[model samples]
Target chain A: MSVLTSSSEAEGEAIVLASLVEGTAPAADDLEALHRRLELAADRDRMLDLAYTTVDSPVGSLLLAATEKGLLRVAFAVEDHDRVLDVLAATVSGRILRAPRRLDRVAFELDEYFARGRRSFDVALDLSLSSGFRQVVQRHLPLIAYGHTETYKQVAEVVGNPRAVRAVGSACATNPLPIVVPCHRVLRTDGGLGGYIGGLEAKTALLALEGVGAR
Target chain B: MNTKKPFEKVVAEHGPTVLRVCRAVLGEHDADDAWSETFLAAMRAYPELPADANVQAWLVTIAHRKAIDVTRLRLRAAVPVGDVPERASTLGVPGALDHELQDALGGLPDKQRRAVALHYLGGLAYAEVAELLGGTADASRRAAADGMRALRLAYAIPERTGAGK
Candidate 1:
């Protein structure tokens, strides 16, 4: 069982070979540059099925993902960016890369929104992650004006299903694009802060930023 | 229970090792090209890869085919050259070329070099190496051992003793 003869010794050989190969593992920046090059190539070839990047926001790190269609999903730090990426890889397409260029517009919009300089997101939306009633609920969420708060009941009524208030709440809870889709604008009928996928502080911050004030 | 991680995670974890294998097989100048091609192809097909598949081995397999393609392309290009010189340092990934080790690796027979590189640098098992290079696991094991012994002798890698066995 010396390090040479066994198949398990392959790892041992890697340990020894790591030093002898091209001095050291090409510095991290080198690999990153190579990765970026690959991202560009993939993009040029139209093979980049999903591209994502993170943006620092008032909420926390926001992971923004997009497809060729448009902005696909927006997730908060609480959602675990890695796990969210994994879910994206599994369900949507594993042809995903952290190519920030695709999300530049999304990040810019978020920055403007958080700075209280923008009223609504003007970016294209890819509502493919939601369908049926959920998709309809998400599509209607953006119409609830920036400074205005819509109760779950009101949103349900507007969506032509007044009996589906709790359904609307679930739709808001599961809204794939939180800030950009404006799920934070929907509230409990009593005006108590409702559930937010980005967490309550984020919801509160977003509403405050929009001049809704804390209820 | 979707356990598949992002392709970015796959690249982050396995990128270096695959780069080493590419460099070991095709030297520095062409290695990055092979690596870029390998990952791009892998990324394209990654959605269909089984969740539990061995990603490193899968990547090495792809790298091997890309390396072969690069070698064939280089042969066809036929820019006459002598020994591959020590690379000048560059802004991007400094090609800290160890010419002696590169020469020793280049001196090896093709199968032996491929065996050593795929098994050691690429971290593929003997069976996987056999699948790539087309021989028995035992044969890949032997070729890798022979290649390593030759490399150690030529490059004068000091034999360590009594660390653990």
Candidate 2:
């Protein structure tokens, strides 16, 4: 497991990195690496299991969580285990599945959240990052507020690595958690909302929710 | 949970749900205040959270409720005024996109705009957008499609043969 895991992780990081630089959807090889990362993702939620639930919203259905760790993860149109697994094996991990019970709260509450000013998340979580820098990045994730975004340069400063713009970009790209980690909040220093793993449209929509005009 | 930190960990995981809600509910500047309020509510209500339920969704729902309350307050506090114009300027504003594409986007209905924003701006899945806006994926898609269609028709983007001038 260790040897396969190490190899998988190394390859996964590479794929994720490539996708980031190129601005494209991850490929099969990329999913493989992600899977390794998932298996190796921190056991912060060790005792807790992967659970989920479906939440209703304006756009579509959301897989939410009711786990002790709060909302674990949310995926969209996420059927077809083979493909999801392929993605998992390449980027996140095969260990993750439809965690309905663990994430049901996401479904139950997101509608209310979308409609109002209510803040603070009550769910616990498995951050699932693997490096010191990654951990540092996660630390700065929550500082970003709604309706606003921070630049990669700004994130580098917050993480105490003012010059590591590339690293900040990498962190945003490799972020195990997307919406939860709030990587969308990271943008370009030139007032441009930067790349988001979830998709540029989603990034824009999230920003637009703030009534932020445009880029 | 071994991978997560205590209070902060869970908050980090689900903060976006609240943020997304607040973004739609408040102004670009007021969002943080709303977000803080949501989190404070979460902190206050944290102890009573269900032991085995999905918590992230719960927090989002709570945030939504809070957002509605605030929007109501803002609407109520506003004073009636003289007749207002049907459209406001989205062009030439500092920090505005100032592009034709932006103008077309500005012309969309609020729901359509929100849908397009979630799809094109927020990076959420169509399903996620549906979840955020309380609609279906098809509806979200159509809204986005409609938004794009309007842009295409108004700006003649699809009809243009040239890549760029």
Candidate 3:
């Protein structure tokens, strides 16, 4: 491991390094405490640009991410939360941290929604991830309302693009915020569950949660 | 094509190593402050850091600056009597391994201590440590070796190789 040293010299440095490491490794508890404290300080100083956390729900573990502007994305465990965070890092800003405090309000709201104690989400959203037609389609999704279902064609019409029905389906399929955006309420014209970002079971589960009988 | 990862990943990957470096350089009492300051500064500048930048070295550089600031403050604020009572009495007992290690590291000359911390704890190569310390890589290796020898002698670290016998 010693790049510039002769074999004997390298072994000597390695032994010293090992002994120092063994002697001075911080306690696990101390490292954990320091990590927690650093995140909080980062948050308070507004140094953290994007904050994320995971919340367990009836669906599965939901990844909640937010910017200073609002909640940016909600991801399902199936989507691979790590990949989602990486995409967020590459696209948005790399100053993302797993700071749960920034996401506490959203987590609570999601918990309430899963428990059927709430209907609509009061949290602000950052829809910057989607743009143009897809963004238009997603913004209309929340208007489908709790406990109400709309066909993909109907959503296409509502967005003033009846010919863009396929695009509307694509938008719902790619909906970044998933459940909070209420994309599950958009069904096939014949009433079959066409597609969902969180998979068919999650779609059925969400529909059932919203008091909509699954077909 | 920004290939940089989230700052959280950087912190998670290198946090323990950085903390160890801080403790080795600043001692347990002042390490936390240096660590917090280092990462806070890192988070602020993360967006602007080049994607290919050696993130661990960047963090250590910030930490090195923070350590200097803390050391300056420590020197100005040093009072022989004030810190004696604050060290937990329990720490004085034998078998307190970290305290013993910290004392050993604290006793080193500045160049040796820094060389040991940066090369061994910060995971920087001798060349990188030299860049930060303004000297040749060979000189850094020598300083670190000297520091490590002293630490082993003070802390009673046994020689692992039978070649020494």
Candidate 4:
């Protein structure tokens, strides 16, 4: 059957409409400024209030997130930025926005650490994501010293559960905050590099950055 | 399965399109306010939104409501003003040809304007546009067609000799 309306006429209308849309589109900078203003409004409203930013590191981009309380999560690029954000949305608050100023201290500390100018992170941390034994394990992980290593069994004993070596490995494997918590410092009792949440290569690199050789 | 991503990704992906729709419906001066309000509302309600929900459609819907509110506010504010010549030159549409198109668009009836904007700029289907505008799909399609025809007539220019027509 023949169409009543001419196809070319409809096509011309579509082209004109498309051009009208293009000509009226707002500038990129305007949109960015609008986003910044919206972010400020959201922050002032104090709804859930999780802010995040990305930092470049020797390994790759790190997603750093924080709350009003303190720095919350630091994730590696391998974890996938989307997935990491989803996790943050689920565990912390879905009210997440990328406001880099909130993570300034974390980024600065990370930059210093990567450049070998800082030995330990000084930012406040929110450990609500970890609990009980895992929390205990993570709390002790940073005590491993900047340039030293600890066996899984030693970590287990340090947390007051010497026989729970496998549990210590699990804690390290599931550490909510990895590099900041220094989970990479825990190794197998046989002096071999153990599993790291950031991957074995990242763990080795971190150890190398700390002037320790992963055997 | 419903999937969710960071709100940043959502904004980065859809900000331009939403801004275009806002500018089309509200003009440049008020579009920024409408855009800001739409995203603020969306961000506030984002967590409760189903993961399977059409994010762009959802955003456009919020924008539609915000646009209506902005239009109402602008109309209310227009009341106390003295007679002043409208600043045609400062209209947000960039080039001369598109400026004519925009002027023609502004002259259309309200239903036709909303129908054309939802269908063309917001990229909604006839049925969706009808639903948003509280009309039948056939009615929405007719309004858009009528608006387009009017635009074509209004936007036409005389041919120039030895120059691109």
| DockQ of candidate model 1 | 0.39
Number of the top DockQ candidate: 3
Name the runs in model 3 displaced over 4 angstroms.
A1-15, B79-97, B157-165
Please report, in order, the local distance difference test score of every candidate based on alpha carbons.
Answer: 0.83, 0.52, 0.83, 0.79
TM-score of 4: 0.86
**Model 4: per-residue lDDT, tens digit, A93-162?**
6778888878888889889999999999888999888888988999999888999999999888878999
lDDT (tens digit, per residue) of candidate 4 on B39-117: 8999889888998888888898899889888877766666555763232222344532256556776777777877777
Give the alpha carbon lDDT tens digit for every residue of B1-165 in model 3. 656888888988888788778777877767778888899889888888988899899999889888888877766676666554322222122332466676777678878988999988998999989998878999999998899878767866554444333
**Candidate number with the higher DockQ (1 or 3):** 3
Give the Å shift of residue A83 in candidate 2: 3.5
Compute DockQ for each candidate against the true complex.
0.39, 0.01, 0.45, 0.37
Order by lDDT, highest first: 3, 1, 4, 2
**What local lDDT does model 1 show for residue B150?**
76
* DockQ leaderboard ranking: 3, 1, 4, 2
For model 4, the stretches where C-alpha displacement exceeds 4 angstroms are A1-5, A90-93, A213-215, B1-3, B82-98, B157-165
Judge candidate 1 at residue A43 and give its lDDT.
95
Native interface contacts retained, candidate 2: 0.00
Q: TM per model?
A: 0.87, 0.39, 0.89, 0.86
lDDT of 1 by residue, A35-122 (tens): 9999999999998989999988878999999999999999999999988998998888878889999999889988888888888889
Q: What's the TM-score of chain B for every model shown?
A: 0.83, 0.52, 0.82, 0.80
Model 3 local distance difference test score? 0.83
Poorest lDDT segment (10 consecutive residues) of candidate 4 chain A: A1-10
